[model samples]
Target: MERKEYYAVIFTSKRTDGDNGYGKMAERMEELAGQQPGFIGIESARDANLGITVSYWESLEAIKHWKENSAHQTAQKLGKSSWYEDYFVRICKVERDYGMNE
Candidate 1:
């Protein structure tokens, strides 16, 4: 079967006061997501008050499943409560993507 391609979900969040727990939760989420059937990979970054994460998936269904996952949902709730003051999620399809190793 040919694999269907999907947009990469890019999430950016601004952290609030108690963000120490975010790192651990984020790592766990990534690890768990990586174990999912359609997961590709993930990349994340953080600055003084901002956190950015990009995760690649095989389909929108996979992304939705991850969003609705229990542990991930809990982390999302905690993100709203303690880690992130605000966040934005964007999905962009890779019509044409290329890279070179340096």
Candidate 2:
């Protein structure tokens, strides 16, 4: 696959020390997401009070399915109640993309 289309999700959060178990959750999410139909790949980053994760997919439906996934829902709950003080998610369609692999 050329991976021309992508869902760019930006998540910003206020993380708590003990509750921000991102290392484990991130790994698990990546493993699960890779198993989903239409999933392409993901890129992510984080800072003191912010986190951004972008995942690529074949269609809107695939993205929706991931959003409604049970594991992801559990993560969301943990994020809201414990890990994150606040956060945001945005999905966008890619019209054109260019890159180089070295």
Candidate 3:
């Protein structure tokens, strides 16, 4: 099947100097996000200093719903307070995508 237009929420973050249950919370959030109405998938990478996570959704409204989720809001607050040094979130329209056919 051909790919269709979708929304992607790009989250880039720099973390503070500790674990502090970030791993557990991140895992939980991913699990929760998968259960959301518009959630399609998520890709993420992290290192000692910085991390990037992108989540795909069927629509902008779905993205907004995930953003306003109560658990996600708590996680965002905790990120600002303890986990992240800085972060940015960008929502973009993914009009086209291609992948290798190997």
Candidate 4:
């Protein structure tokens, strides 16, 4: 099933310096996000300094719920304190989308 409208949360960030458990935390967060209500999909990429992740949801409420998740809150604090130098989150409405699979 596919929805004609949805929401996307785009997360862009720059790393502070080292691993400092960032890798494990990121993986864990992704895993946890997959279990959230209204979660549609996620795409992510990262290099040495920059990282960008986009998560899709069915509604703003679903996105909000994920943002307020307990473990996610802790990860946010850890990100600010130890992992990320800077970050930005953008929410966009997806009116239409299409893709082809080979």
For candidate 3, write residues 1-102 as lDDT tens digits.
456999999999999988898999999999999999989999999988889999999999998899899999999999999999999999999998887862
Q: Where in model 3 is the C-alpha error above 4 Å?
A: none
After superposition, which runs of candidate 1 have C-alpha atoms over 4 Å from their true positions?
1-4
Over 13-67, each residue of candidate 1 has an lDDT whose tens digit, in order, gives: 8888764777688779989999987788898888887788999988888888889
Cα lDDT tens digits, model 2, 1-102, are: 255656655565667776468679979999999999989889888877677778888888998899899999998888778887677777888877766851
- For model 4 the local lDDT of residue 13 reads 99
lDDT of each: 0.83, 0.80, 0.94, 0.93
For candidate 4, write residues 6-96 as lDDT tens digits.
9999999999877899889989999999999999989999988789999999999999999999999999999999988899999999998
Instruction: Compute each candidate's TM-score over C-alphas.
Output: 0.87, 0.83, 0.95, 0.93
Ranking by lDDT: 3, 4, 1, 2
Pairs clashing in candidate 4?
none
Query: Which of the two candidates, 2 or 4, achieves a greater lDDT against the reference?
Result: 4
Write down the lDDT that model 4 would get: 0.93
Model 4 collision count: 0
Q: Rank the candidates by TM-score, best first.
A: 3, 4, 1, 2
Worst 10 residues of 2 by lDDT: 1-10
Counting clashing residue pairs in each candidate, in order, gives: 0, 0, 0, 0
